[model samples]
Target: MTIRTAVMAALLGAALTGSAVAQSGGDVGGVWQTQAGDANVRVSKCGTQLCGVIVSLRDKIDPRTGQPAIDDKNPDPKLATRSMIGVHLFFGMKPTGANTWSGQIYNADDGKYYASNVALMGPGTLKVEGCVGALCGGENWSRVSR
Candidate 1:
């Protein structure tokens, strides 16, 4: 009877520890540097989902204007003059998997929004994919400190 009680307690403890690990497995909140090191985005909870904003740029000056870059390529006239800083790269990113989120990603370089998904490849790596029609490509983004 004593041995059986001890075994049951051990099993229960293991199960509880596993649950704690599971809870931390899906956390994707942090700053991530783009594969090209062109930009860094800060991702966090928007409402119920997640969103990322442009926090910095490697080249702050736009050669065309010889000043800080703006979203001149954006189709909307109102947004054309908007500054590149604080631009929403992705919003309404819904959880598609335990370690992935799917949504649209804004590309300021081309002034287009592509179907995209982000997944955690490891503790310090994230895979970001963008698709145009049938052609899809992705790159690994490294997690960065705030």
Candidate 2:
């Protein structure tokens, strides 16, 4: 093949490879349902990082009071009265590797922040892990359609 043809072929191959890499990395922006099926979080880009907000909850009422749930567990008294819905629980997640991100996650249940990592296991599956001190736990979340 002529030199020109060879260079063109190489460029085209590089472009295809780049596209595949991007697709394999996956997009984290979407709605994901927690493993317990208790909540659905909407993940989206916040500046250059990713953030997730509670969009829906299986139980909206506080069992003890029969009123809408609040972030009463939050350590900060000023924030404790805020509604749980629309609360940003995942923050500043930066891409760490292909299909994976690292950041911090706030556990409203216990009112604590933990080092967190998330990975897209598949087109519809996500693995989320949170570590506090030395102990760590994780759960698999599924993509929510609409």
Candidate 3:
């Protein structure tokens, strides 16, 4: 009877430990960089998995023209589109594995949709690869302190 009790306790402990590991995705919370810019991203579970959301944007300047990144594709040409600020920008994301994620990425600049994937290169860096149909582009972004 004593041996049976010990075995049961051990089994219960193992199951509990596994549950905890699955809940935590090996340290996945912090300011992660993306191809667009440094974004304050919150990594958390959605339903039974994990995802990230953009909380901030860094260097609102457009790297290509050294000017402000503006949304010029709005049908309402009279709407004074701001440099940065919009919803449905990064609607949702899903975790793929160790620092990798896949989801829809909204391009505020051109008002286009692209299938996007993100790879956290390090605590201070990340790689964002995005594709539209057969065309794709990628870039590395550095994390912001905030």
Candidate 4:
């Protein structure tokens, strides 16, 4: 290709890459809003490990009881009364890479614990995965406010 054509192609490539990078953030820490927009979670350092906590909910009150929503699905009876807000989604997650961690995560939807991994895909994206035996599934969370 001619030099002028090559330069145009390179600029186009750079522009596309820049756009993707703009959409993807570079840092992991921040409050992230889930895909469903039902809740906001703050992932931060809890001592030596990173932990995620439910900070806000779209529906904070339980419709059935007209009170605050709770972790009714928790395995431990003692924890069942705890509110959904401030509940730990994943704790004891040890860093496995510069922006990844491996640990167990609580699934309120199923009220069970599963092997889980958290990775920073980009500044604006976080990849969270949970596994039951060999089956694994995950969703991407987006940064709301840094």
Compare candidates 1 and 4 on lDDT and give the better one. 4
| TM-score, prediction 4 | 0.77
Tell me the deviation in Å of residue 57 in model 1.
Answer: 0.5
Q: In candidate 4, how many clashes are counted?
A: 4
Worst 10 residues of 1 by lDDT: 18-27
- Per-prediction TM-score: 0.78, 0.80, 0.54, 0.77
Q: Residues 1-146, candidate 3: write the lDDT tens digits.
A: 69999999998887666545544544445555555555555444565444555556686676876876555665456543654533344335556555666777766557666788766676666676778877878887666543
lDDT of 4 at 21: 48
Off by over 4 Å in 2: 1-24
State the lDDT of candidate 4 residue by residue for 1-146, as single tens digits.
99999999999988666544433434566899988888899988665467899999999898989999999888889999999989889967876655677789989887898999888888789899999999999999989987
Error of 1 at 93 (Å): 1.2
Query: Which residues of candidate 3, in runs, are more than 4 Å off?
Result: 1-23, 26-28, 32-72, 75-83, 86-88
Which candidate number maximizes lDDT? 2
User: Residue 53 in model 3: shift from native, Å?
Assistant: 6.0
Error of 1 at 51 (Å): 0.6
Sort by TM-score, top down from the best: 2, 1, 4, 3
Q: Return the clash pairs for model 1, or none.
A: none
* Evaluation by TM-score, superior candidate among 1 and 2: 2
